[model samples]
Each structure stands twice: as structure tokens, then as C-alpha cells.
Target: MGVLSTFLVSWLGKDAMAGVGLADSFNMVIMAFFAAIDLGTTVVVAFSLGKRDRRRARVATRQSLVIMTLFAVLLATLIHHFGEQIIDFVAGDATTEVKALALTYLELTVLSYPAAAITLIGSGALRGAGNTKIPLLINGSLNILNIIISGILIYGLFSWSGLGWV
Candidate 1:
């Protein structure tokens, strides 16, 4: 979605594109933490299942989900409250316009951190359970939906007004 958003934001202007791109880089850094949690969940769940301990597997999955969700919420709150400062510090000498745009992008995307983190955890658990197909389908559907929604919002369909980026 970030990559597609960068493409959609390009029509807004160079600054908007650069802003989204930079924001995505930072987002990836944050996502890395989620990914680590996801991997740990996968390992624990897989090990439990390997030992034929469904109860342990369930507990591991539940605990990881709770921890990841709480972490994501706290991270999102911090990012939402200090987005401008965070962007400024990360962006260094970038122009004011670019920094502002990046902050806007970061603020909007931060709202999804909880959901995204949960999804990752869910997918990891599913993969651990040897149900890879479901995870693939869920993730694929989300990416397709994201692309469609991004396109419609960035360049409205029919007569609806969009962000005028088109």
C-alpha cells in the first residue's frame, strides 16, 4: 500500500511524493518491530504444535496478539502526538513543505498500526498452524483492496471529488 500510495501521491506534486516516500521508509522501520514479534510468535506456535501441544500453541498465539496490539497502540499514539517532531528529526534538511507533508502522511498511516500489527500476528499464527493458504488469501485480498481504495480516493471515480491529485 505504501508503494502504491507513493505512486498515487506523485500526482499531487514532487513534495507530496517525496513526503510519502520518506514516511514509508520510517514506517518500515516501525514495522520491523512488528515483524520481529510476528516471527517470535511463529516460532513459539510452531514449536508448540510440533510437540502436539495445542494448548500451548493457543496460549502463545493469544499472548503474542495481546502484546503486539498493545505495543502498536502505544507506538501509534506516540507517533500521532509527535509526528511533526519525529518527521523533522528524521528528515533533517528537507524543506518545510516536505516535512509537513511527511508528517501528514505519517499521522494518517499511524492510525492503522494496530490493525496492521494484528494482521501480521494473525498471519504468523496461521502459518505456524500449517494453514498457509488462508494467510496468503487474507493478505492478497487486503493488498488488492488497498490498491483499489487508494486509487479511488487519490483520483475519484466518476463525479466524486477527490484530493485533486489527479
Candidate 2:
């Protein structure tokens, strides 16, 4: 999605690419946090399952989900609220267009963090359950959906203007 975002709004010029990259870099921090939670969940659940203690595994999974859910929501809210300031601070030398687009991208993508967290943590649970294929398939499907949506939103269909690439 990061690479595609640059392509999607290429007409906006190098500024769009810089903005997308900046937003993407900031977003990666959120992802890294939840990814750690996901990894920990996988390890804990796998260990509990190894001990043949399904109850412990369930507890571990539920706790991770609850914690990550709240964390995800809080992270999303903070990013959505402070995105412009954050972008400005991070890209101090960037042009106003780049900074503004970075803020826009950050704000728009911030809300999806919760959903992303749920999926990542759920995938971790599945990994513990020894069902890696499900997560692979889920992520693949989501990627396809993202490509299609980005295409439609960037290039437009029918007579629309793709909102002029936002």
C-alpha cells in the first residue's frame, strides 16, 4: 500500500511520494507496536498450547486482544488528532504541499489501525493454532482489495475525476 500510494497519486508529483513515505514511516511505528504484541501473543499461546492447557492459551489470547484493542484505539485517536503537528515536526524541511498531504494521509489511515491490530493479533492467534495459511490468505485478499480501491480512488472510473487525487 505504501508503494501503491506513491503510484496512485503520482500526478501530484514528487511531493506526493514524499508525503506518502513520511506517513508510511510514521504508521510503521504503530505497526511495530502491535506487531510486538502479535509476536508475544503467538509465543505465549503456543507455549500454553504446548502444555496442553487450552484454558491458559485462551486467557493469553483474550488478554492480548483486549490490550491491543485499547492500545490500537488510543494510538489511532492520537495520530488522528495530532497528525498535522506530527507530520510538520517530522518533515520540517518538506514543502507545505508535502506536509499537508502527509497530514491528510496520516489522518485518513489512522482509523484503520484498530482493524489492522485486530487482524494482526488474530493472525498471531491462528499461528499459535498452527493455521498459518489462513492469515496468509487473509492478508493476500486484503492486499488485492487495497489495490483495487486505490486504483479506483486514484484513477477514477466512469466519468469521475478520482476526486483529483484528493
Candidate 3:
């Protein structure tokens, strides 16, 4: 929520707070599905690991992979097909640039769903094992990587470097 709020403030500005608020309202609808999958995987993985049942843990991990894959595919399809409409519905009379930027951001964001799912699984497994430091390190490292990548991609900061070939 803090990240979203920061993004809303930074991207949309204060004038569009109402629109951002509405977008967040619609986002909560999708978050319901996300919460279901996330909570289910966390519970199953934690319980299995708590019991020290490696076989059950493995099974739960496999099941979560399958489920998350399906969800990623479904979400990608939905975003690809109806993303513009959804954005429009949520944004109402927002500025065209803001709406377009929001849609593009959403499209780019979905591409990371697989990585997010992997991180979630890893974190869940670590939580089950009662060792959270590793997961925290993993998440922090990924966030740093994301910031670096986003800076390069969005700002063309490394365009001249040409992967050190120049």
C-alpha cells in the first residue's frame, strides 16, 4: 500500500488523487484473487514444513507453481485484451497522458509476475523453515535490481554504454 500510494502521488500528481483513488479501488478487486492464491500457498507450505514433511512440502511447492503459472497466464491474457478498457473505466476523466502512462506501466508490470511468484514461493518456503533472513535478503536484492533496471529502461541511462562494447 505504501508503494502504491507513493506511485500514485509521484505518477499522477495531487490533482489526480481522486482518480488514483478510484484506480486503487478497482485494484482491490484484482487483489482479492491475488490474496487467495498467496494465502493458500503460504498456509500449505508453512504447515507442511512445520510438520517436517519434506514430501508434502515438495508437493505443495509443485502445486503452487502450477497454480501461479495458470494465474500469470490468465492475468496476462486479461491485461492484454482488456487493459485499456479497465484503465479507462478506472481513470474516468483523467488526463490522456496519465492514463496512457498508467496502462503502459501495467503492461510492463505484468511481465514480472513470474519472478514475483518465484519470490513469493521462496519466501513462503523460508518462512515455513523459520529462517526469514535469507528471504529478506532475496527480496531486498531484487528490489535493488528492479530500481537499477527501471532506471536504465525508463531513463535510458545506459543507452550509450552498449553493454561495454562501445
Candidate 4:
């Protein structure tokens, strides 16, 4: 996303790139929360698996699911509701169009957090089972999909192509 933003900014203008950067930064902050949750989940799952307690393992999985779901929903809601305000706050003294674009991107991207949470929990569980290959494949696939989606959506290569100045 950063590369795309830089290219767009260079091709179009600072306002466009700055808007993209703001949106990306906002997304990164939200993802950081998920990262912490993921790390905790991984540790807990590993501990349960190490103890050889199937029941506890299952419970750990459920607890992570519940926690991640609530967190993702709350965070998404906050981002969606205050998204414009956040854009404005970050892009102070910037162009109105840039702020608008940044808010739009943020609102649209926040929906992905729930799925991301699920993925993180699932990967954590798999890793706990000592099945590193599956988790690696899943993460790699996700990265590839992310690259394709980002290119298509953010770069306006698909339906959104006409939306940006680029």
C-alpha cells in the first residue's frame, strides 16, 4: 500500500498520496491491535497444547474467538464512525478531497478486520499443533491475496480505477 501510495502521489499529487498514506496508517494502527491479540492467542494456545489438555485447547480457541470477535467489531465500528474525523485530524490543513478519499478508504477497509481476526486465530491454533506448514501456506496465500486486492482496489485497476486522480 505504501508503494502504491508513493507511486500515485508521484504520478498524481501530494494530496492523493497523503490521503492514501493516512488511510494506510489508520489501517495499520487497527491491525496492530489484532497483532497483539494474535500474539497472546498464539502463546495461550501453545501453552494449552503443551499441557496435552484437549479440553483446554478447545476452550482457548473459543475464548480467542470470542475476544477477537468483540474486539474486531468494536474497532471496526469506531473506525467507521469516526473515520472522517480521523482523516481530518491526520490531514490537518490538507485538501478537502484528500480527506474525503482517506475517509472513504478507511470506511471500506475496516470490514476486513473480522476476517483477519479469524485468520489469526486459526493460524495460531495450527501453529500450536506443530503444523507449521499449513500456517505458512495460509499466511502466504493471504499475502498474495492482499497484494492482488490492494492492487486492484487501491490502484483503481478494477472498478475503482476511475475513482482516483491516477
Candidate 5:
């Protein structure tokens, strides 16, 4: 999604793309929580299943789900609150215009962190359940949705003004 957005926003011009790409990099860092949850959940669940200990697997999965969800929500709130500073901090020596545009983009996108986390956690949980198909299907749907929404907001379908400045 970040790569696609880097290209899509390129139509906005170079500074726009640079800012967004930088912010995307930060977003990826935040998303590392998903991988942590997935890895921890997978290890515990897989270990339990290997030992044929259904109760342990179930307990670990439940505990991990709660902790990951809380962490995701907290992270999303932090991003929404301080996302501009984060953008600026990560943008290095980028021009002010680029930083402003990136802040605007972040404003439109910061709330999505929690939703993405839910999807990520769902994928992890499903993996723990030993069904890879569901996670793949869910992630596919997420990618398609990201494209559709970003297209609408970035390109302004139906003559509505796009989120980005033209």
C-alpha cells in the first residue's frame, strides 16, 4: 500500500511524494507491532499445539489478542496526537511545503492505525488457528480496500475535491 501510494501521490508532485513516502516509512515502523504479535502468538500457539495442549494454546491466544489490541489502540492514539511531529522528525531536511503536505496526509490517515491493527491481529489469530487461507483472504481484501479508498481520496472520484491539493 505504501509503495502504491508513493506512486499515486507522485501525481501531486515530487515534494508530495517525498513527504508521503517518508511518512509511510514511519507507518511501517509502527506496524511492526503486528509482526511482534504474530510472532509471539504463533510461537506460543504452535508450541502448545505441538504438545497437544489445547488449553494452553487457547489461553495464550486470548491473552495475546487483548494485549495486542490495547497496544494497537494506544499506538493509534499516539500517532493521531503527535503524528505531525513524527512526520517532521522523520522528514529530515525536506522543504516546508513537503512537510506541510505530509502532515495533511497524516491527518487524513492517522485514525486508520487501529483498524489496520484489528485486521493484523485477526490474521495472527487465524494463523494460530491453523488456517492460513483466512488470513490471506483478509489481507487481500485489505489491500484492495486500501487501493480503492486511497484512489478516491487522492484522485477525487465523482468530481469531489481530492484530499491532496491539486
Candidate 6:
């Protein structure tokens, strides 16, 4: 989804594409951390359930979601507060326009971290419970939706002249 978003942004111009690409680099790192945490949750839940311990499995899932969500919120807040500095540091030697655009993208995207963590963690829990189909469907649908929405946002529902497709 991040890569697809960058591709869509690329249509806007070179600077926009560069900015989104830079921001996405940082986003990927953050998401990799969440993926690691999700892997742990999946292992714990799978192990607990394998032992036929429903209670422990349930507790583990609940605690994992709560802790991860809280952590994501705190991380997002700090990133949002310091986004400019962070982008500046990461975007060294980039043009001012590119850096500014990257900062704005990062700031906006930080707000979604908590939701992203919840989705990743919840899907992982489901996978641990032996329901892999749901996670597959969820992720697939989200990617499709992201593409559609990004297109509409970038190009609008119709051409600006209102007489042809964008």
C-alpha cells in the first residue's frame, strides 16, 4: 500500500514523489517493528491455544492488543510532535520543498499508527486462533480500498472540466 501510494503521488510531480518516498521509508521501519511485535503475539497465542488453555490465550490476546495500542499512540504522539526535526534529519540534502512535503506526510501518517497496530495485532491474534482467511481478506480489501481512494483523492471523481474521465 505504501509503495502504491508513492506511485500514485508520483503522478503529481517529481517533488511530491520524492517527498512521499522519503516519508514511506520511515513508515516502513515503523511498520517492521509492529510486524515483529505481531509475530510475538501470534506465537504466544498459538502456543497457549495449542495447550488447550483458552483462558491464557484470551488473556494474551487482550494484553497484546492493549499494550501495543498504547505504545503506538505514544509513539505516534512523539513522532507528530517532532516530525519536522525527524524528517529534516532523515531528509538531509533534500530540497526544502521535498523536506517540507515529507514532514507534512509524516505528520499526517503518524496519527494512523495506533489504528494500524490494532489491525496488525488483531489479525495476528486471529491467525493464531487458526483463522488465517480473515486476515488475508482484511489486508487484501484494505489494499484495494487504498488504491481506489488514493486515486479519487489525487485525480478527483471526474476531470476538472466535468466532461471526461480523469
Give the number of the best model, judged by lDDT: 1
TM-score of each: 0.95, 0.93, 0.74, 0.83, 0.89, 0.92
Query: Tens-digit lDDT track for model 5 on 17-107?
Result: 9878877788778778677777778778878888999999888888877777788778777877887788778888888988887777766
lDDT of 3 at 37: 69
Best by TM-score: 1
Model 2 lDDT per residue over 62-165, tens place = 98888888988998888888888899888879999889888888887887888888889899988997889999999899889889877786678899867545
After superposition, candidate 6 runs with Cα above 4 Å error? 158-166
What lDDT score is found at residue 157 in candidate 2?
Answer: 86
Spell out the clash pairs found in candidate 6.
none
Candidate 5: worst-modelled 10 consecutive residues by lDDT: 105-114
Q: Which runs in model 3 stand beyond 4 Å of their true positions?
A: 1-36, 158-166
Better-scoring candidate (lDDT), 1 or 4: 1
Give the per-residue Cα lDDT of candidate 6 at 74: 97
Q: By lDDT, highest first, what's the ranking? A: 1, 6, 2, 5, 4, 3
Q: What is the C-alpha lDDT of each candidate?
A: 0.88, 0.84, 0.64, 0.76, 0.79, 0.85
* Candidate 2 segments exceeding 4 Å error: none
The alpha-carbon RMSD values of the candidates against the true structure, listed in the order shown, are: 1.5, 1.5, 5.4, 2.8, 2.0, 3.4
Residue pairs in collision within model 4: 156-161
lDDT of 3 by residue, 47-112 (tens): 987788878977887888777867876786788788789889878888886676556656656666
Of the candidates numbered 2 and 3, which has the greater TM-score value? 2
For candidate 3, list the clashing residue pairs, or say none: none
The sequence of per-residue lDDT tens digits that candidate 6 reaches over residues 21-85 is: 99989999999999998998899899999999989988988998999999999999999889989
Q: Which parts of model 5 have CA positions greater than 4 angstroms off?
A: none
As a TM-score, model 2 comes out at 0.93
lDDT, residue 96, candidate 1: 92
Q: How does model 6 fare in lDDT?
A: 0.85
Q: Provide backbone clash counts, one per model.
A: 0, 0, 0, 1, 0, 0
